[model samples]
Target: MEPVLRNLRIGRVLNEIKKVPNCMLLDVGCGFNHKFLSTVEPYIAQGVGIDFKVPNVSFRKIRAIQMKLNETMPFHNDSFNIATMLAVLEHLEKPKQILDEIARVLQDEGKLILTVPGKRAKPVLEFLAFKLGIVNRAEIEDHKKYYDLTDLQELADQSGKFEIVHHRYFQFGMNNFCVMKKI
Candidate 1:
């Protein structure tokens, strides 16, 4: 991904989570770098990162777990105060199931922060990222779908356990950012 786009997404997520202090965060599909978790470590009290693969580096106050998003999360109920799934929801084959799991582990007052490629700009992004080689093709292939605001709202609705708190387009409408609260 382009640094500017990446910063926009990551920065938006970080900014939203910063409002809730001393939060225990669960970063779903945190990737091998634990990049997001590491970036937010200073603000959060504790954090756990789960992905299909292990991370290459470890940081204090953050635990890394290797687990696929499609499967049951290993944590118990009400395990976290905040949960984030940056750029991960569109790639899930079972997004509803995973959202259910995320809701299960989050406190009733917990918040979910996430980002996905905007449906309107996805095709153009694919063309630029893949054919033009402006972005990583390998990363683009991992996405099963791109989400517009409506699609994201529907997913939150289908979860039956969350209410959309905020939704907006960012990065010049190339991406969608959502903040949902467990209900």
Candidate 2:
């Protein structure tokens, strides 16, 4: 129903947000509009959104910054209570480094909520983007990889920075949802 799936991912992230107390959030790859940040505005005390392309708009509780996720963030250690990388991991060239950086910035035991397309979505996504012309072709073309639940668990285990506290599949098993706590 949505274009490939932004709304579904946002809903999943919001559900994870509700499990934690009010927090200062770091939203990785918050796009030009800061839709997710805006949607969660009431749930967070304040927020910082970073991406390679973000507008200069200044919202009341958000400071949008144009920065690359591959580089270390400017925040101090344990700077945020929660960090989210909704649908952003698959596009990163160095995803583990980015996750490590996220872990560095999050307070101890803080949560990292993320969603990535499942491995099964490869052909489905390709068809939606190329044939049906529904999903964003640019995004599908940019995906570095798709992951399964085992892949996610292994990645987090290898990082030694986070533990996948909760995980589930949604969108008819086309996507993965995870709540990882900083170890």
Candidate 3:
């Protein structure tokens, strides 16, 4: 993703968390570089980042774990105030299960903030980012599917545990961000 777009998404997510002081967060698919955790550490009281591999370095407020999305999360029920899956849902084969798990781990009023590629803009991104070499092709290779707003809403509804609180298209409609509350 473009740096500006990535920052926009991250900034928006941070803004949401800022509404609640000293939040505890779960960051799914947080990569080995600890990029997201580093940015969020100072703001959050505590955080856990789970990915396929552990990060090389750890932050003071964040714990990194190596794990897959489809498997059961190690966390207990109602463990966190917020959960985030930035550009991650599309890469999971069993997204519904993951969504369910996210809901299971979040507190009753906890929020889920996520982003996925816009289905309608996939072709354009493929052309510009992959075909034209403007962006890294490998970065898009792991995506199992792209999601439109409807697909995301359906997944949230199917989870049977969350209610959409907010959603909108960002990055010129090439990406989507959604905030859901545990219900």
Candidate 4:
């Protein structure tokens, strides 16, 4: 994971977990990268990591599920204290739909934490490719769209089921930190 993104997630998650106890967390689009998971090991009672493919890790404590983002989450309602989607929302077709599902599965007043690249963060590379008449962006990369601060803020506000507890600009707001609480 990139340092800026990784650190931002770690910091936000730690702060959020401090407010709750016996926490069970759900990590969406967890991939194989579990740095943040390891960081919260002390506070987490049970952790579930879901991705399209399972990463090779020997730890049996962390439950990794293979699943698609656009479908229903397999867990029961109000199953977790916190749900995290790190560097993942931009990859999905209906991000708000996913958030609704997250709200469904999380306890009332549960927390959702996520991070995504700000709209301006990678514009230079994208623009240079345009000038060179070449598409350098990775096709498999899950970034369907990049979001500016206002877009993210609006998404948080109109998320349908959750209240934006805290939203901050990261990496100069070219990246964003969003904390939503289930209403």
Best by lDDT: 2
- Candidate 1: deviation at residue 114, Å? 0.6
Error of 3 at 112 (Å): 0.4
Q: Which ranges of candidate 4 are over 4 A from the true structure? A: 1-4, 55-61, 124-141
Q: Which of the numbered candidates is closest to the native, going by highest TM-score? A: 2
Relative to the true structure, candidate 3 reaches a TM of 0.93
Each candidate's clash count: 0, 0, 0, 1
What would the per-residue lDDT of candidate 2 be over residues 1-183, giving only the tens digit for each residue? 453388888887887777677688999999988888998999888999998889756778888988888788999999998999888989999888998999999999999999999998999989988999888899899999999999898889888999999999998898999999999
Error of 2 at 107 (Å): 0.2
Better of 3 and 4 by TM-score: 3
Candidate 4, residue 113: lDDT = 89
What is the C-alpha local distance difference test score of each model?
0.86, 0.89, 0.85, 0.76
Candidate 3 lDDT over residue span 1-183, tens digit each:
466666887898998888878899999988776677789787899989999876534568878888777799999999999999998887888999998999899999899999888887678867877779887677677778998888888987898898889999987887889999999
65-106 per-residue lDDT for model 4 (tens digits): 777888899999999989998878878888888888999899
lDDT of 3: 0.85
Write down the worst ten-residue block by lDDT for model 2.
1-10
Candidate 2 stretches with Cα past 4 Å from truth are 1-4
Better of 2 and 4 by TM-score: 2
As a whole number from 0 to 100, the lDDT of residue 93 in candidate 4 is: 88
